[model samples]
Target: MSENEHMLAVRSRINDLAAKAKTPEGLTEAEKAERADLRQEFLANFREGMRSQIEMLQVIDKDGKEVTPEKVKQIQRDKGLRDD
Candidate 1:
């Protein structure tokens, strides 16, 4: 599945688990493990999406100087994330 699809699935599962835990008794061990795994997947997807947005960003000073961070530049260069 695409990242978006996977993320949606993860979110749905996490929500389901949360609703289940509102009952008299909480989730079973296996359900708890699944919830944890889904939460991890959701976080991983969130971080990757945030990283992509940051990578696509360019910081310019009042002098029109490109001030993007050195590490970000290197990451872009290494990964060919940008065209310029």
Candidate 2:
């Protein structure tokens, strides 16, 4: 598989693990810890992806406006947007 495909597979697996963790018959303590760590890793990856997209948008917009996370959140709130 390509690198992108591998990354997608890993992300899918992480999502599956997260869903499992959320169940009432959830993971054991060690499994839960592992899931939490994986979730954090996924979150970091997701945040980085969002930052990159925001940077691209800032370049495209190029209106001398700062694009911080707060700004993004405010825009989302104003526009009634939610992350899928």
The candidate that wins on TM-score is: 1
Question: In terms of TM-score, how similar is model 2 to the real structure?
Answer: 0.50
Model 1, 1-84: lDDT tens digits are 996787788898899899999988889999999999888888888899899988878899999999999888888988887667
* Candidate 2 C-alpha error for residue 60, in Å: 7.6
> For residue 35, what is the lDDT in candidate 1?
93
Give the runs in model 1 whose Cα sits over 4 Å from its true position: 81-84
Compare the candidates by lDDT and give the number of the best one: 1
Residues 1-84 of candidate 2: C-alpha lDDT, one tens digit per residue? 985676687688777877887898877788767777767776787888887576434222378765446666666556566342
User: What does the lDDT read for residue 52 in candidate 1?
Assistant: 92
Worst lDDT run of 10 residues, candidate 2, spans 52-61
